[model samples]
Target chain A: MLTAIREKVLAGKRISDEDAMYLFASDDIFTLGALASHVAYRKNGRKAFFIRNRHVNPTNICVNRCKFCAFSRSQGQEGAFELTIDDIIGKLGKGQATKAKGMGKSRSPRSVHVSPHGFSEVHIVGGLHPDWPFEHYRNMLSAIRKRFPKLHIKAFTAVEIDYFSRISGRSLEDVLRALKQSGLGSMPGGGAEIFREEIRNRLCPEKIPGERWLEVMETAHRVGIRTNATMLYGHVEDLADRVDHLSRLRRLQDRTKGFQAFIPLAYHPKNTEIEGSYTSGIDDLKTMAVSRIFLDNFDHVKAYWIMLGEKISQLALLFGADDIDGTIIEEKITHSAGGLSGEKLTAGQLVNLIQKAGKVAVERDSFYKTVRVYP
Target chain B: MITQEDNSRISRKEALSLFKNADLLGLGMWADMARKGLHPEEICTFVVDRNINYTNVCINKCTFCAFWRDADDADAYLLDRETIFGKIEEAIAMGGTQILLQGGLHPNLDISFYVDLLRSVKERFDINVHGFSPPEICYIADASDLTIRETLSILKSAGLDSIPGGGAEILSDRVREVLSPKKIKSSRWLEVMEAAHRLGMRTTATMMFGSIETPEDIITHLDAIRQLQDRTGGFTAFIPWTFQPGNTELEETGRVERTKGRTARTSKLRVQSPATAVEYLRVLAISRIYLDNVDNIQASWVTQGLKTAQVALRFGANDFGSTMIEENVVAAAGVSYAVSTNDIIGAIRTAGFVPAQRDTHYNLLRFF
Candidate 1:
């Protein structure tokens, strides 16, 4: 079964759903990784990417209160707080000033394409605040764009966009377009937890349904807003559930060709209602390799270092991951769920990790444009 | 004249070269081929056993070991006969067929203490007592003024079944001199295994890499094991596990050096980074390819976790090693991956192999 899949992959043909399932269940991880690496090399030759970005989670007060989310808090709950637009900009401004000084000394002058704020992207995703108006999110994006004109502001998930549409009584396209006009460059892949309706419901009952999330993404794609796709695995999901999720994403990508990358989020079991352990390195690498091999239309697969820790993310490069996400100034969602990786990584450190893995470290913007390549 | 057998085997130079330059997945393919040649069936094996640490008090305080304690340490303990019996009884009730009976090398305990410990367990329950690693045996023999052969004869009569491959971190004396100066040298450890093999006792071989040793040291360890296995075909398996640097003195020294803003090279004790999964799989596959004389290669889920262990099945490991009803050594290092017997079986089946229950000698007892 695996050999046939390998042949298809080698012959530049797309593998079927059954083939992806077999690769997931197969113990031949080395071969799977090798095949995935072959495909990844064809797409990206010896180049791995990392972005100099900051993750600005504006609020944790969410109305959905999904069972698997340890990062969300109810309104007025203890530890529940919302960051105003000023607060978000203040954080990003301070972080950028400090990082710019560090980058000036370490980064090569030729390779360091320092933005006015030192970082090329600012990743913004937060809970759906119960009280905040949809205009508040739009204003937040516009404010960040005003402060740092050069920064690529990649904000909001499909679920958040869906919430925005509901709260504003607007259609999905209207909300996405409004945000885009307010400086939303792209969307981060989240809230697409599992496309299998049964598992998705059990994992996050109050969250938007799988179909709604897909609809929201499809709407965003049609509006010319490119986004990444994600599947949360290792929590109340099986191989078939994962295969179903990937098949749905692949189908959507075939139609829209809007997914810039596929990021497989490893479910962290800390502080969450989900009762399970962390995903093993074997499973993490296998997921990366499988996503890269299966998502033929997607140009990149990101090993989100915030979830995979430093070492496994480096190994994921060989397992078909060509992007390590970025130097996330601070990450909250995974940490709230007992994420063991450091909250932030320096740009120099990110380059070192990719280089040590025997790859050409390419600094990328939010849309994965090569800003600078560190050979 | 070169024979087909010699051509089939890789030399120390070739092994070292592979360690230095071989592509990880390429090495894995070679290893998977090697594994298929040995284990043609779609079967992987494991043992349902408990690691009964009779004592934690030791004199040889190796830096890499977090399980040892001083004789007077507040937490140090020596299990009594009844306590040992109770644990073995619990193990048997849980369908455990063997007990990995090992402990620290106490300076006070003589050969009689070990003999009685084995005899008492064998008298009450019919179980395989895979007891006494080479370090413990060497310590016991030296303390009792007996030869390694004499010590083996005494323990065999009392019910010692076989030896485990603990305390063989790396066979290079240069590594041993730095990692554990007080423990026996590489030759003495091999001598104990040789004596046990001569007595018709099958043992296992292990290598704990990812410490300060270079690629040369790893090949040296593999070569030593291969040479010994050639003389005595008593090794049932070769298990290569990464050194877990959690709560151990080694990690502490590294931390202290980093805090002082000094590079690792400036200090006499170079702090070792924990081995990544890539290095673990590379060494594991190479072990399978290099030790062609050895029949089985066991994966260390106890350190690498179950997922990597599942991957190890195709990387030349034919066994899941053990269910480990109880394990303390690696736990002391702050890395304890607890999985039940059913979990091992499930993982094997999920990895697309038949999970079979095996005894100490690799003889199949049952299949799931």
Candidate 2:
């Protein structure tokens, strides 16, 4: 049965939900590996990839107390932080330069003031705060882009957008339009749990509904801003639910064609509303390979270093995944949730991870432009 | 395969048969080399490193892990600075070399916190700073409002040796979306690691599989790793393990509900036992054989433990991974396995190979 599924996958046939179950239960590990290999070969070649960018987490104070959260605060938390526009830029330059130092001690002293190539993008995302109006977002984004026009600004996840729209008394369309006009270049696909309401209901009760989040992404895509999609796993969600999540994303991508990458998030389960969950390293690898097989529309499968730690991310390269998202200057959402993914990694370190995996490391822009080849 | 009795291991004919199906053959003369080495290398190994999760009270709480808690949790804590130093000291005194230093995605711990921690360790003893897994880096970035590179730079500058190759579970958005939905997905992980590699930090790689995927999925994981390895020659090794599902909500009552809590954790260790671990060993060997580019094939005594780990040597593993001073993640999964340098050397000697201490790049530091 597993071989049949493998055959189907190798033949480029879309694997149905039923086929996944049979493959899961069967004992044909090699055949399944072969099919996955076939898929990888047919699509993404062996390329260790990273994005040269930074995450600009605008605020940590949020209204939605989702089950899986270690970063969100109710505004009264002792250590809650919200990066002002200046603070965000400050973080970016410092973050990138810091990463560059890892590339070499000499790399820094020469270009500390100007920052040669450390920080990547100003990844602007934050908690879904009702208090912060659209103007706040506009100001933050406009300031960052205006200051660092060369830097790609990937701002706001679909869930945050939904939150902002409802609070701003604006439609999702209006919200996106305003943000786009305010220089929101792209969307970061966060707050997307399983598309199935069953899983989302139990795991994240207060966040946007499954369909609404997709609708927001669709709108962003329609508005000409490319975004990435992500799935939070290792929680209450099931295999079928995971499959449905990917299938749904695939369905949407078949229409909008907006998603630049598909990132499978490894649950941290550290300090969140939901309790008791963890994903094994093996599970992390398998999920990535499955995402490559399942999400046919996505061009890149990112092994974000922040969540899945470098070791698993390095191993992730072999599982049909291609892209690793850019360096994050200051990522708050996950960190606040009790994850120890990493303090941060430099481009040099990323190249090292890929080299250890025996793949070529390529730096890409937010728009998926290949920037530089490390080796 | 070098042994005559191992003729039953794999045939060149079988390897040739696999070449067309396996993607490794398409690159360079890997097929020819693999043909000589019996395709798939058929041997893989892992290293045993202590997880020493110093503290569970983290500020960065992305939604995919269950190993941490608030500082107030009954089990939450911050290992006394002395205690952390003492653990490494003890490991070093006992012949440990590598220390996987990681903590909760703590947000309040600023640049000075790590600088102080790293300086303390560097001053205390000579140990490889296999610390600051990427998530920790991202958390530090967020806490300090620095980019990953900036965080890495500060850490590296402060006697921070190398980054631990932890946290990278998968490199696909679909899987990350459902699993960690909020945590930086696959790409961010890759981005940071690449940045570090460019910075000259020799890191390692790893993968956790079997939770929510098909076999084809595993290949995708391999593809992602392979691609990165082709770029910067910074990563030193790759380790893969199964998720420990004890306190985890899904495994507790899911389809495998029959699995008892604590007891099942032990069984899960065996899930990657000598047999499975050896299969992975073969895979590791195959990785080396395939990635002629990569040099070391490590034995994972950490996840598989000492006994089975020793057996990995004959299966094609070369390096006896790290002499971890403390390990916590696997312990969280409930595996009680820790070994000092003496233990590693003893294991290697028993396995008929000489033991050698090595740095992040696998360059032999000294063989006692």
Candidate 3:
């Protein structure tokens, strides 16, 4: 029944709620893959996408002690530190240093993977600095834009915005407007852990509550910023939680086609108060495929290898994912938590991976712009 | 070569049929019935080493996890090198051969941290430093500002033995989006894996299923692993585990009211259940039966415990997984499934199969 419903849905047929449930719960993993694959083929075709962006997590400082975080620095600790605005700009300015160093230039000298297409977007996210107010972000965004106006900037998670609004004593709308005028392109889909509050109360402790997280995203969509959605898996969540996470994203997308993609974050349980076995590789794949099946309203599903590791990320392509994210020249987020994937990728390397997975690789911008097509 | 040609034109239905009735080829009744071909001893083996992820103070607070420390959290920590050194030093003393050392994407650490650790382990003791998944590799490459090849080279020079294939969920982007909105994607993951294989690092392929995927998607994951194996023969074994939902963000997202009777809907465990013996059978049988390019399919007695793991053997599984000695990840998910080498031998023997100890690559450790 679920298989038939999946076939009907993929054939441009509308499926009921019961049907959706059956489709997601089917025992046949291949059937899941096939339905998700068909949907992927219809939406994005054979094109796999990545981008040439730099992750600008300038400060690892944060006040929230969300249980799911393996990254972030306290106000002052052994390695606790913050990137000065100059330091932040200096990092982004390395796009030029990147050029000078030959990041994209095949014969260039810089040691990172330089894509054929140069950096197209700058991912601007940082821990919500307890001291820095909304204006601080304004100044930061202004400085970044003043320096690299051409680069589209996608910054701030829902949690950050919620915090920013409270700090600035304004509404989310006012804050979003101010940030946008200052050149905020879109939002990053962080803070939407599992939508179930029971887990949220226990795990996240202090994130924007599940509803507020969606409220922010839906609000952002209303204001015209296409954001992405995400679900952290493999630890402390049930399949229903997984389904509900997708269901929320799907419903929101139904109202405001704002989510450009979905990402499955694999939980790596290292260095936290909550100690447990991490999600197995099998669990990760199941999450990825099910996300694809449930999130029919979303356009693209990304398999971020930075967390999933490489082999499973590659395997994700067959399950339902289409975009492989970008080659971040220098990423700051993963390292603080003991990240293993070095913070950059090149066009050549990206091409090889997509091809190796039997797909075409393309570089994309923040708004899902086609920057370079390696296929 | 001929099989490749055949596979090129094989229909999905034909491939699906293998999930049901394909011959397991090497280790079970069919291997005995047919003229003896590939010997089990010759095939690469999988290990039972405990994956000791000592820290979760990751800079990469990816969206899919719920088990990491907020840098400011009182619970955040980093293990003293002594504890780590002791962890491995003891594992080796207890007949363990490898250590899978993967941490969250951390920041501020440099090459020296990893190199020093690798060197200390290599010089003081002789063990395979099968640590650092590709995501970790990506982090290393970014921090040192070296190409992945360059970082891998430095690690190799510093006595890095091999790579542990972890963090690979599904390679598909559609799946990746809902899971982790901010990490590396399918392409980069594969790129790093391929680069490692090219750089002479042996890796394993794994799939974490049941929480949010389909059976066909499961096949796709296996197929992806098989393709890479065909190309590099770098993967030593294939491992499949069910999702364990405990304190993750995904768990907090949605819920449905539960009812006692098995009516229209029933509340179920989040990850795939190991108790579904038939499901495990089909998956195990299909893995051994279909992943023609792969050599060993590990029995996840760790996830399934010993009994189902024993059942997996007849379902085409050959090797019993870890003596783990010590495991932190699965234990976090509320599973206390642990077994000693002697217990494993007894289980395998009880299941009517020979028990043997093997190395990281399935080579017999002088036969049991």
Candidate 4:
């Protein structure tokens, strides 16, 4: 069966779901990687891309308690805290002069530009705080955008967007439009824990359904906002479920051509309610390679080094992964879920890892614009 | 003939076999190993230069060129000395160390025209004059009724520092006959380069692939450069660029010949597909392994964009070619990828190497 699949691949035919299932079940990791590497080279040669961005999760309090999440806390939990707008501004390098300017803050004359960290984008996602109004979210984005007018703000996931719509008594489009007006540049690919209904029900029952997530993504695409697609694999999902998830993403890309990348998040099983071990490195590599093979129309495949360790991320370069997310200044979501990768990597360190993998490293912005290509 | 072994010089047959059946990743790894072995100081280099096409008027209307114009065309242009000097001044202001002076094979330009141009530029600027490919030199020699050596000597005395390898499209005469028959014969191009090398001038070797050339023909091209470099050791780098078919005579005539009532046989001569990125990297790696005598392999960012050119560093390229302050020929071919000095430095750093600015003779100017 593997031979048949390889033959089809070499003959320039698309691999069927059965072929993907067979590949998933195969024990020969080297052959699977080689097959996927052939496709990877066909798409992009020996180049792997990274970005220089900061991760800013604004709040950690949520209403729904998903089984696989360890980052959220109840309203008064010890570690649960929402950053005040001033706190967020302070983090962005505006000192205490503007801290007294209450909640009704207009874009002030851009205060002392402190740390030019060379960040091209800011990745913003957080828990759905029950008390804060939608206006708080809007103001947060607006303030951040005003502070760093040049940085691309990839804020909010589909799940958060859906929650905001329900809270604000508006349609999804209105909520997205309001956020866009507040300077939302794009959407992140999170809260998409395996698209299988059964698995989604078992893992994150109170979260948005898989269908609603797709609908929100389609609506975002219709409004000319591109987003990255993701699948949280290595959990209870079967091989068939994984293949189906990739196939659906591929079809969506066919219609919209808006997905910039497909990231297969490795499910870490340390602090969540799930009672199993972490997925092995073999499973992670195979998942990444299979996603690259399946999502042919998708322009990029990202191996979030925060989920997969630096070593595995380097190996993923040869296994059909072209992007190893970025510096991610302070990543909390992955670390809270028992991901042991560091909270940050220097641009120099990331470039070294990519170069050590014998691939050229390119630093990109959040929108996949080439910041630089390190030859 | 070179010997084929694990520790000896690679033979032509072994190199050809690598082109045919070597594993792509393994071949890339070996080529990169060879690059690191040759350039042990972890640095990638580029020159800040402008491709100054002095004129676009040409008599030999090669089918692959979109930058040429007839002498009588309304839009035809020949830059005057003032404009040329102004461009050089701008390039110097932008920290350019060299000017790649090339133009079409103009019908009536005598040797004195080139010598005077070289003299005026040298008199005004303290930059390197890397001018004239072999075909252009041949045209000038024929027009002036001088031998190739006399032509190169005269140009050298007039401040022509080096030569560019533009006309060696493919060293296989069979492919050259179909691709650029009117330009120059393969042997004549090699002869001109040999004459330049004998005059103690350094030159670069280039191969414009992805045309109607076979893998065997590509190997033959690399062999020609390798043998020449073995004899003269004057070739500084090897650059391989894809033949962009957009806005070319090939695309224009091949697509509309039938509409113009030409026979179907004429359209059959078209190159149907542009070479894909995978093909580009594969051949690029193979060229690095085959052209062992050439010290540098340059990535063509003008033909392949920044991303693939970045990837070329891993596939055995050690040079970013140039910052290309001003380029007209490849832009005329309808493929334009521009990069600044900072972009080149950033790309080189991202590729895990220090970036250095160099002169036309591969002399290190500065490291960024």
Can you give the TM-score per candidate against the true fold?
0.84, 0.56, 0.57, 0.58
Q: What is the DockQ of candidate 4?
A: 0.01
Better of 2 and 4 by TM-score: 4
Docking class of 3: incorrect
lDDT of each: 0.86, 0.66, 0.68, 0.81
Clashing pairs in 4: A373-B347, A374-B347, A374-B350, A374-B351, A375-B347
The ten-residue window of minimal lDDT in model 2 chain A covers A24-33
lDDT of 2 at A272: 75
Instruction: Using DockQ, give the best candidate's number.
Output: 1
For every candidate structure, what is the RMSD over all alpha carbons to the true structure, in angstroms?
Answer: 5.2, 20.6, 19.5, 17.7
Interface RMSD of each: 3.3, 10.7, 12.1, 12.1
lDDT, candidate 4, A1-375, per-residue tens: 888888877775788888888888875555677778877778778778898777888899999898888899999998998989888767655322332222134366464542324466788889999988899999998998887787688988999999999899999999988888999999998877788899999999999998899888989988888899999887788899998888888888889988999999988766899846456555777788888877778889998889887656766777789999887778888888877467887776677777756678888877677777887
Candidate 3 chain B: minimum summed lDDT over ten consecutive residues — where?
B257-266
lDDT of 2 by residue, B232-291 (tens): 877777666555554443343422322223242332222211123323443444444434
lDDT of 4 by residue, B1-368 (tens): 22236676677777778877765566666777778788978788999998899999987766677777877778789999999999999999999999999999888789999999999999999999999999999999999999999999999999999999998989998887666668889889899998899999999989998878888899888888888888999899999988888766566344332122233433544754455555676788888887778899998878876545666776789999989998898887767655678867876775567899998978898999
Error of 3 at A245 (Å): 1.6
lDDT tens readout by residue for model 1, A1-375: 777899999998998889999999886777888899999999999999998888889999988867788999988789998998889998888655443644456454454434433677888899988889999988998888898888888889999999899999999989998999999999988999998879977888888988898899999999999999999998999999999999999999999998999999989887888757677667888999999999988999999989987767887998999999887878889999978578888777787778767789998877777878887
Q: If both were scored by TM-score, which would come out higher, candidate 1 or candidate 4?
A: 1
Assess candidate 3 and give its TM-score to the true structure: 0.57
Q: Candidates' DockQ values?
A: 0.26, 0.03, 0.03, 0.01
